[model samples]
Target chain A: MKPLDKIQSIAAYLDEDAVDTDIIFPARFLLLMDKKGLGGHAFHERRRVKKGETPFILDRPPFDTAEILVAGKDFGTGSSREQAVWALADLGLRCIIAETFGEIFYANCFKNGVLPIRLDADTLARVRQAAGREEEIVVDLPSQTIVLTGDETISYDVDAYRKEALLLGLDEIAVILRDSGKDIKAFEEGQSRRAPWLRLGPDKWKVFDDLEKEQFIE
Target chain B: MHAHDRPRTLYQKVWDDHVVSTYQDGTQLIYVDRHLVQEVSSPQAFVGLDAAGRDLHRPEAHMAVADHAVPTTERTATLREGLAASQVARLSTNAARHHIPYVPMTDRRHGIVHVIGPELGFTLPGAVLVCGDSHTCTHGAFGAVAFGIGASECECVFATQVLRQSRQKSMRIRLEGVCPEGVQVKDVILAVIARIGVGGGVGHAMEFAGSAVRAMTMEQRMTLCNMAVEAGSRIGLVAPDETTFAYLKGRPLAPTDTEWDAAVANWRELASDSDAVFDQEFEIDVSSLSPFITWGTTPEESAPISGRVPDPAAIDDPRVRRRVERSLRYMALEPNTPLSGIAIDRVFIGSCTNGRIEDLRSAAAVVAGRKVHPRVQAMVVPGSASVRLQAEAEGLDRIFSEAGFDWRHSGCSMCVGMNDDRLLEGERCASTSNRNFEGRQGRGGRTHLMSPAMAAAAAVSGHLADVRDLWPEGTK
Candidate 1:
């Protein structure tokens, strides 16, 4: 995964609180085995203005060129459907800025290599206003600076570990692997000593052994 | 410390004590005590178990139930849907394989797991409980630290009985004074959500306390805790009181006589000390809270029942404004439209959240003399077989039937999209369940979350009218 340096273009802001996974990728779309076609149907209910015609959001100028989303608090609040994050990612939304995000959705965003930036209410308002004006909004990850075309800029805070993960394109699992260099072996040894029943299956034991080897080698 | 400076909130005390080891990555591996499992999401965890060929490390500490996918009609030999049938069957098999106690569909003890847990005394005060179902926070009413977990996390709990959690800052939400007449606990939670704007509780553990909270029954507290997730909090809790002890006194899993006495003594100490600290505190005057109805897709986008739908253009926040407009368009609701006159097609009055005996009694009281609207479809499902039997003995079922509601068996019918019980496309329902998420009741079905009495009132009126209007004069 390429490191995110800065965001250049702003998406026409779509604002909704608790935009659930169901609305993003409806249950009908879940039938499709391939995830590539999902981006086409992203926000399908909102895309059709008159059942057949493309909706205003899709036909609008900034949304057509936008690669980032500015959203409200509790953005993406419902079910733990990874497909929602996948749909956003496939739709070319590289970054999302919100005042707050759902616990699971925030994790999913990082896992899918999408930058979910938490901004203060004032900063988020500015970004939302900028999107409305079709003005360029720039977000420099390293400097934690959000700049609008009118020479307006704001600095936001990101957790150091999350920033590192986003920069390295590593997820929680990746971080676990990276950090568990010796811990995995120690955990396995403890498991073997404490609970012998966990060591019954050769395949099961091999799975843990493989995980240890993978993390140790890395 | 000043009088208000002391820890007057229950959230502060629980959070402060539950902090386990914080990882270098900023996440904490908080210890979890009780793990609750259900048919819907536990199957995936079992599949993970099969792949790993792992046995449950603490099977005795885990419990499973069939709730979401089971039918409310009857515990038949076979289920109507193949997937639903297979899921319930797998839960039974998996529970047996792992030595986890299970409340299967056919069992007389069966019901929504969250409902039965507290009633049967499985949810103890101060214990951390987690389930794959979102409303698992319902257990928090018993003063238990509870929240929802995903399937992968459920596996982690099954394997280790401990969740890798990031501890939240505590927020004490103090509600002073007595609740005004006709204002139910549901309204209190809604008012809190409305004031907090959903994300207000994010990264914060909310402890609901004060005179108003202490006055509520165990069932009412459960309803308040049930929607904690709606406020974007992982858990909602209240300190255990006399009401909590009374509710747990004689249940099957509750402590025996001597143990019960001892348990009560310990539970008394669970309250926050007068000098405990909290990260944040907010006070709400209970007298000001009114009956609330959600008008938009989200719970936070709500207003008083007598109030008009908010115009998105009037909102100062651009993000909130844009979403409100979109939600209004999708819901087919107009700005400034009167919420009272909107018609409802169905009424659902059962879930882990609000399917207890008291909730049924309240609904039954409202439906006693009123006939359900001619066009509306109404169903009354109890939380568990025990609740159903108790209601039947009290003739609550007859009142529900007379009012044109289908008095059905126990299960999480219509609350989630796992079962055959669902609202048809474009159908609007007055539901007593937690969550009004799009497609939660059914694909394209709209849900209006409310109290059971409010749902009953709507069933009779066939609209989103206020329950206060339906009550007899001087009754409140």
Candidate 2:
């Protein structure tokens, strides 16, 4: 993950609400475990060029190279597939602004270094209008502001911890392992003592293992 | 020491019990009691773990299953050369290498992660369960603090067994009165989503309570919580009661002998205090709910069976209107058209949402002595292999087979178009799955979300028909 301090790029608009993860990254490609080169599959159906069909916004000139996406309400909704974030990030999109986002998708964005911004409907419309005009947008992480054409700037709120995570490109697992190792172990020991029923040994596994060994074929 | 005296919701109790420490930035490191993994979303997490030189923190706390892309028919042979095979193989290899318990594809216990976890008694009351799949919240019917996490978080749990998290506000949804005849528990949840909209539960943990909720069986409660993600809530809860306890009493993984008594005593306390306060509250009378189904793309774009397709022009909000128009275009539906008369090409009767044995029983009851409409290709995929065996033992599979509905193996079949069971272009389906998002079933496919009984009725009638019409004595 690259540290994201500032981004300036042309914005693309998608005028549809509740654009789900399946739409962003279809389930057919979910079997590809590797996360690289998923951008080609992002909005796979929409990007397809058929005879006598209008070209998709992302496939049009200027917007074809866009680094920011302005979407409608509840964007990135449905499915817990993080590949939705990966697909956008792999597509060279650095930022996504929407009225709202699915909570899991929002969290997945920070993990993959793609910034998700939640703006009010009015502010979102302004962003969309700016994108429709093909204005180059600048998003400054440190200032938490989006700079549009004519130097018009709009401020946004982000979780302080997430903002820091994005700015520093911190590996959360590494941080937790370093700072909370003892704390986690202590909690586990205490929890086991309190509720011994949760600690299952090989005996519990015997049934599943026996079944697996006996019946490995369909 | 007086923490016990303050009235806290069920979410608070479960959260408080699991907190390991608090970071300076106010993110709490909560210990996870269970981590469930499936094939599709877990492969990359395992790769990350390998790259980080990390081993499992507590292997016993994790379990894996393959359901997302596994073929319902000819499982192994169908997966022999494709991407699905490789993915399932990776999960199997990852689980074995990490010493994690994995229920293999052909194992009798094998099934959708959410379904098997509860039935096998792995999902415990007051436990913190995280899975890579959103439907992990289905376990919340056991009064657990369960939510879905992304792959990065999956790797984090794999290494440390803790998550850095901020607290979500609490919302209590109280369903009062009994559901009218022909209105299944699935209808109750659909009505809630239709009332609350898709984003209604955002940034909150929803606790489902009241008379209707209390009256539901454990399977029904699971169905209710399973679709909470579609309502945009990561966590969903139901206070553990006798229904939950009774469901888990003799399960293989549940506590037994003297330990069972102690576990029950502990679970009995897993409820909201009498005067507990919630950040938001919603009350709905279930008596008025009808058999509900989504006529548009989003789950919120649904109405009672008697209603008509919503007209975008009639809606006041421009954003909502545009969304409705786009959904109507994708669904090929006309505004003001009756929802009941919409013809469908297929009927899918399995998913983490409604693939349990009781769901099968209800659908089988409706399909008994009736043949599937020739125009509709209908199939029933059990939630788990055990669910399949139980259904077979009860002769439900025979009823479905005799009725010309494909009685298939257990897996998340047509709910997601990952496997062979998919909708062809322009094909519309009546599915018992959760979402109705554009192209969710197939690239150009349309979906209508409903209950198993409703889907069965749609199968026989070749259109969206009210299940009440089939039940002459009215549904019990």
Candidate 3:
């Protein structure tokens, strides 16, 4: 995973709210979760340049090199396929500036070192307009602001932990292990004290292990 | 909590209970209760784990199963080759190496991950559950705060058994009015999504309540919660009640004797308080609600079974109108044509959403003495192996097979176009599974999302027909 910080890129627009994982990266190519060779497959059907077919937005002017995808509300809405984020990242998209995002997709973005920045509705409108005018957009993680051309800046919100994780090139588990071992131990103790039944059933293996002592089941 | 401060909704309660600590950046370290994993989304997670030299924090908490990647044709069929086979094989090896228990493809316990988890009683109330599949939200029917997580997050949970989280606003969808016979819970959920638009529940926890919802069976509740993600809500919850306890009472993973009583007592407190205020509220009167069917590519583009395809001219919004027009083009339908009279090429009655034994029984009753149309190729794949066995013991499988529906093994068949089952180019289907995205069934395949009974009726009639119209005697 590449570390993201200050990035400047032309923006492409996908204005449909509830832009789903299937539309971003269809299920047909979701065989193995690889991060490379997926950018071309992004919007696979829509990107095909068949005769009599109109070119996809990305194939159109300005958007040809656009590296920031400005999607609509509820962007990345359906399915938990992380390959959607991988496709965008593979396309060299460093950030997705959207009004809102599906909770799972938003979480996955940070896990894969891609930033899903949520902006207010009015700010998104300006960003979309910026995309039309071919304005270069800037997303600075340390500064926590999205700067459009001409000095106009829209401050965005990133989870405090996530911002630090991005800055430090840390994934959630790495962060938790490095900084939150006490919390994990506390959670385990609490679970044992309060929610013992939550432990998996009397080990199916344990009951069978006794017989396994006599013979391996397989 | 002050008077102005509303009682915490069920979502807030569970979320707050799980947070180990909150960071300045607004991410909280939240403990995970159940992490259900499947083959399609987990192979890479295991790879990531191996690369990181990390092991599952609590392998017991992670329920590994092979669902989406295995064939539904025969349990004995070996997956020795291809992408699906390798993925399934990797899950077994990963589970074995990690000391996690897996309900293997040939095991009687093998079923759709979502179906088997609850059947095993692993999805407890007041817990936060997650899986790599979107239908993992089905577990929220037990009053657990369940949602889907992506593959990378699956790796995160696999390592720490926790997640970095932000809070979601809460929405309470109260299904008021009488639910007449034949209007299944599937109809109620689809109608709710249609009324609330696909994006209406975005960034919120959807907690279903009111008369019609309370009246539904556990299977029906699962059906409702299953598609809540389609509405863009991560969490879909129905407060735990006696019905929930009854279903959990004697299941394999559930407590026994004295512990059972104590556990039920604790779960009884999982409901939202009377004064709990939701950020959004919606009410749907089920008295006159018809069984719903999606006519467009999105689940929200739905109408009553008896209605016509939405006319683009009637839509004032140009963007929406164009989308509807495009959807119609893909679906191979004209604007004013009745949705019912559309011909069907295939019918599928399985998936985590509607592949339970009850779902099988309902579809079977519709096709009991009738044969599937010659033009339609239909199939009934159970959600789990146990569900298949139960349906068989009840002769439901025989009924479906006699009706010309191919009864197959357990897995998510004909849902997301995986496995060996897929629709041909331009073929139309009536599907009980959630999702009607373009080519969700197969490349260039059209889909009409409906209930299991409706799918069965479409199988028998060779077109999208109303189940109520075909079975006038009412649901058995």
Candidate 4:
């Protein structure tokens, strides 16, 4: 994970609302565990004609070097596929500005060290317009502003806790375990005392594990 | 808070009970009741665990099943080629090493992670169920607060048998009437999605209530909760009742009669207190509902079977008009076209939503005395091996086969399209699964979400037609 303070780069564009993960990475490639290099297959149906071909958006000049992505409303609205976020990250996209995002997908961006910033329609349109003109676009997450060239800055919003987590390069697990070790221990101790049957030791666990593989016979 | 102010929703009680600790910043660590794992998501989490040099915290907390990677074809036993095979292999290796309970394909209960949770009696009321898959909300039918997590959260849950989440706002959708003749729970959910847009229920846990939902069977209840995710809600629930207890009794994982009575006594208190206050409420007159089929990419883009495709000109919002235009282009459909007469390329009658025996019975009734149209390709996949066996025992397989439907094994066959089964380019399909999103079934495949009976009717007619007109006499 990496802290995302500020990003200044050419921005790519995708203007379709509800741009689902199915199109972002497609289910065909979902079986691949490694998230690196998935950017090449991002938008497989929309951007590619055949193998070794860069089709519509990615084939453009400045977008090829984009570090920020500007998309329409409800971006990443389908399956909880983190591969889409990984694809953008692998392609060096640190910031994605959209009108709205799918709930799970929005949460995923924070976990993976990517920023999903919700911009109003007017702001989204202005950003996309700026990208079309090849103007330098800067997103300062810590500052909570989208900085364009010529001193124009637009305020942005993020979950307060999430913003702090991103600024500190912290994962949710790290944050939870840091302060809750005592609480969890107490809870576990109480649970064991109350429900002794649930405290399955390794010896007792094997009895249940074997039952999991019980086969069907005709 | 005063005594009069203490009627908490089920969401509140379950959420409060599960919280291990809360921080000053409103970040809470909640204990996970069940962690359902599949091949597609678990492999990445396993890779993360190895990279971090961390072992699984609690093997007993996890349930691993190779579902998404396996195909539903007659030829089972081995996985198909490509990442599907390798991913399943990774899951097996990881599960074996961690000593977690792995549901093998040979196991009769091996099925979609959501289906198997209840079938095996692992999903209980007043618990929290988490999975990497979005449809994990399906498990909420048993009164659990279930929701999907990303691969990163999966890894977190793998390393620690708990998850960190803020509480979601609570909502209730009350349906007050018996379903009209020929209407199924699938139709009810589709109509509900149509009324409330895809984002209507966002950031809320919707509780389905009223007399209609109370009358539903356990399987039908699962069907309704399954699509709550598609409506932009992570969790949907029905209060635990006698039906729930009866369905869960005598299962391999369920407790004995004495233990069950005690558990039920606690679960009885998990329901929303009378006069409970919800953040939002929506009521539906279920008797007025009709069979619905999605006409476009979004689940909200739907109309009843007798209705017509919506015209962009009729839309008031410009952004909505733009989305509908793009959807129409991808679907190759024209505005104002009668939904009933549109021809379909295929029919898929299975998935976590509509793959239970009740769904099979409904589809079987439609195909019993009719032959599938020669031009249409129809497939019937059970949700689990046990479901398949039950279908076979009741002769549903023969009816499907005789009517030109390909009867197949269970495992998320054509719904999300990860494995061998998928639709070709420019194909139009009537699917009994959730999500009508573009390329959901395959590349360039158009899906029309419908009920099992509607899909069966489409297969027999070679087009989208009203099931009421095609309903055979004496059918349930």
Candidate 5:
């Protein structure tokens, strides 16, 4: 993942609320485990209602190259599929401005170097208007602001940790393993002594008995 | 300071117990007690781990199963090569390489990740459980601090056995009063989602309490907590009690003998302090909630069976009205039409939400002397093979098949629409699955979410009929 500092592009507008993960990236494509090439499947329903036709707003002229999306409240509201972000990022979207986002999706956006910004209703209305006109918008991560048409700027809030992670393109797993290894080892050692039953070893598992086995096994 | 000195909600207690490290930004690296993996969401996580040259930190603490990708039909000697097969194969290889406990498709214990976790006693009180699927909240029924994680987080768990998480505000929803007759546990959860709109529980850890929740069986409690994600809350918890202990007693992975006593003693303390404060609180009288069902797209876009399709014109909020109008259009429903009179093309009675033995028995009881309507193609897919066997032992499968319904093998089935069991385009279905989103069952497929018994009733009547009106005589 590359560090995301700023993006300047037209914002594609999705006017619907509760634009859930399923709608963004349908559940059917979940079997496609490879994260790449999902841009073709994002919003699979809306992008092409028929073969050889692209009717969705994102597929249209000026918005086709959009790196920013302005959507209604509760965007990415269903499922914890990270593929939703993968698909959007694959679709060339770098930032999403919404009234609110599903908490898991919001967290995932930062992990994938996609910024999810929750703006106030009034500011969101202005952003929506700018998106409707296909006006160019600039999202600057360092400044934590979205610049709309006519130089009108709106500030947004993101977790300090997530913003830093996104800007630096830090691999969170590597960072944790490097910084917190000792603490993690200590916690586990202490927990095992206090609650041995909680940390069962492989040999301790007792899932089946020979007699009742007939009931569970084929 | 002693842990007991500070008043804490069940969530706070569990969160405090799992904190391995805290960062300056207020996020904590919380140790995960149990990790459940399924085929669809896990393959990429394994790839990422391998790409990072990381080894699984605790393979013994994780379990993997191929549920969503497996067909709910009789298994062939081997799966034909394809996307589904490749995904399942990848998971199997990953499990073997990582030494994680893998339940193959042929294993009787193989079932929906959430269902098998509790069934095999892998889920326990006070454990911090996670899976890539959002329905992992089902484990919270046992007082576990369980929630869903993305595949990236799954890799983190594999690499470090901990996840970085910020604290969530606590919300307690009290289901007061005795549940009225004809109300299923599914109805209780659906009613709760309806009360708190899909986004109502966002950013909060929901604790289901009050008398009605206490009266529920472990299976019933699982049903209630399974759809917590549908309400936009990542976690839904019920404090462990005698019911929870009884359910865990002698299960395959559960503690036994002296260890059992010790585990139970610890679990007894996994409850909210009497005077603990919640960030937000809501109380719903279960006595007042009737059999709930989704009439439109979203889970919250539902009303009681006695109600009619809402007229979008009557809605005051333009955004909500537009959404409703679009939902009604896709559902092919008209305003003011009685919910019961809406005809269906199919009936599907299963999912993590309502696919347990109890759910099967309830549906079977309704179809005991009846037959599926000639126009309806109904099926019952158990949550797991264990659940299927248990249902068969009780002869529920016979009742379902005798009623002209398909009694199929266990998997996610039509609930996810990734397998062979799917609704054809524009097909209207009365299903027990959680989500009713467009294309959820299949592209252009319409779904009306209901309880298993209600789904069975729809199979018999070929419409969204009330289970109460069709209950077999002499049965409650």
Candidate 6:
């Protein structure tokens, strides 16, 4: 995983709030069984383009170079449908800059390696203006600076843990595993001592023991 | 202690009792007593189990229902909506495979999961329940700590039988004086949401109490709690009272005979102690509230029937101003438009929120001698088969039919667009359902959330009309 030093691109701009999961990826396409081709229908309901649209959001000029989505308040408000996050991630949107986001949607973005950035109204207006002018908007994660093509810039901050997670591509489970490294071995030893029912037989035991032995050797 | 300090509301008591363990990170592991599952989110849980070769940890504590994706029409063969049919069938299959009790669409117990939980006595007082559906807060009317959980969290509960959660502070909303005629529990909740704004109750549990709430029926209490989520609260509760005990007396899973007497005795003690403390308190004068209607996209963006649509400029807060403007555009309403004269194309009076027998009865009473507007499409769907049967037995269904409304089978019909029942694009509807978000009913469909009686009045008048005017003599 690469640490995000600066976001130099202003990929695309969505104008509305509460863009629900149902519209993001309709339930009809849930039958796809795989995540492939989902990007084609990212904003199917609202997309003005016809079917067989080329390059999807990437086909649009200024949006093609934009790595961030500047959106309205309460962006992604309804439903806990994770497919919304998947579709956006598949579209290669690295970050979303909005005034506010739904609690579940914000959490899902972090889980899927999308940095959700919150900015004040004046900053949002500047980005919106830049988007209208087809100008490039740059966001520097480390410096917390968002610069427009007109030489104007604004600073914003994100939570430290969320910043680390996005930079390392670490999800909640990954964070938990990282924090529980020592606890895992202690838990395994305690389970073997007190509740051996949790332990596996010889064939499975070999796999576990081999891993434990490798850890000891390391 | 202040008046708000009495027993700290039911929300506080239930939330405090469910704390399992506090984590070093400030989150707490709250024990879930009953977990309701559905097909939409449970497939991932089963896949997770299959990957780990792990059996269900507490199958007995969990129950499944097919409601969200179930087709409401009477088609026996293939359904017009293939995805919905398959989702319903998958729920049945998964519940059977896991040995969890399931109420399929063909079963007598079939209905919205939230409605069935309380009807079957699964949502007992002081229990902590969770469902994949957001309206799970409906169970809190039974004095239980209930809220919605995400799919991954659902899997965690299935494996460990406990959910990790942080404790929330409590808010007590006290209603003084008797409820004025024509005003219902819906008006009380809507008024509270409008006053507090949508995020006022964030990170807190709300307990509804006082003279007004105490006088309400169990079904009405359920309606009040059902919209707690719209206020951004995790749970809403009313203390178990005589009305609550009476409603649960002959329920299928409720205690019987001597056990019933003992249970009532115990339930009576579930009220808050006189000296209990709550973090915040709000009071509303019930007499002042009238029949309410949501004119905008959000539930909190609502006003009384006689009031005019709010001007966005009048709202000083930028977020609220933006919401007001956006809602007006989606609803196609002018800033100063009177709510009374706004015409509607359809009327829907059903959902887990307000589709119970009491709700049906209230609507039926309004439409009994009236005729539905010829241009309007009106529907009344019962919450459950039991409610349907009860309405039919009392000829309430006939009253609806006589007024030219379609009285259909029980399901989450028209509340969400998943099923065949949906509002046409660009058509405005007066609905008794909880959400009024844009396109919630269907693509380009407009929804105005209201009470069942108000929906009934709108069906007859073909516009947003006050139900109080229909019953000048008041709820007799």
TM-scores, all candidates, are 0.81, 0.97, 0.94, 0.95, 0.97, 0.81
Docking class of 1: incorrect
Interface RMSD of each: 11.7, 2.4, 4.3, 4.7, 4.4, 13.7
Tens digits of lDDT, candidate 2, B1-476: 32878999999999988889987887798888889989988989988989989899889889888898888986444565577778887888888889889888877888999999998999999899999988888999999999999999999999999998998999999999998878898999998998898899999999999999999999999999998888889999999999889999989888899888988898888899989999999999999888998998889888888889998889998867888888899899999999998999999999999999989988988889899999999999999999999999999999999999988988998888898888998999999999887778888999999989999999999999999999645446
Q: Write the per-residue lDDT of candidate 3 for residues A1-218, one digit (tens) a residue.
A: 66778888889897666677888888878876566778888888778688887688887877878878898777887888988888888877778988888778888888777899888878899999999888888888898998888999888888777777777777567768898889888878887768666656446334323211111122
Flag regions of model 2 displaced more than 4 Å: A214-218, B1-4, B75-77, B472-475
Using lDDT as the measure, name the better of candidate 2 and candidate 3.
2
* Model 4 chain B worst lDDT run, 10 consecutive residues: B74-83
Question: Candidate 6 falls in which docking quality class?
Answer: incorrect
By lDDT rank, best first, the candidates go 2, 5, 4, 3, 1, 6
Q: Write the per-residue lDDT of candidate 1 for residues B1-476, one digit (tens) a residue.
A: 12444544555444434444456776655445567788766776787666766667567667688787777886665573366666676777787778777666666667888888886677888667788756777888888788776665677667655555566777788888877666777888888888887667777777888888888889888888888778887788889998998888777666666656766776787787777777878899989877888887877777888899889879997766888887787677888999998999999999877899988988887888899999999998899988999999999999999888998889888887566688888999998877787777877788888878789889999898888877755433
* Cα shift from native, residue A10, model 6 (Å): 3.4
Taking chain A of candidate 3, what TM-score results?
0.85
Q: What DockQ does candidate 2 score? A: 0.63
TM-score for chain B in model 1: 0.94
Off by over 4 Å in 6: A1-43, A49-59, A64-68, A93-100, A106-218, B1-9, B78-81, B255-277, B310-322, B472-476
- Cα lDDT tens digits, model 4, B1-476, are 21435888988888877788776778678888679988887777888888878887778778888888687875354564466777877787788888778888767768999888899877888878899998999888999999998999999888777877888999999989988777899999988888887777778999999999889999999999999988889899999999999998876676565666777887888889998889999999999988999999998899999999989989999888999999999999999999998999999999999999999999999888899999899999899988999999999999999999999988997898988889999999999999888888988899999999999999999999999998877765
lDDT, each prediction: 0.74, 0.89, 0.84, 0.85, 0.89, 0.73
Local error of candidate 1 at B183, Å? Answer: 2.2
| Cα error, candidate 6, residue B286 (Å) | 1.7
lDDT of 4 by residue, A134-210 (tens): 88998888789988877889999887888988898986666666667678778778866543323334654343555
Residue clash pairs of candidate 3: A159-B25, A160-B25, B111-B384
**Chain A TM-scores of all predicted models:** 0.80, 0.94, 0.85, 0.84, 0.91, 0.72
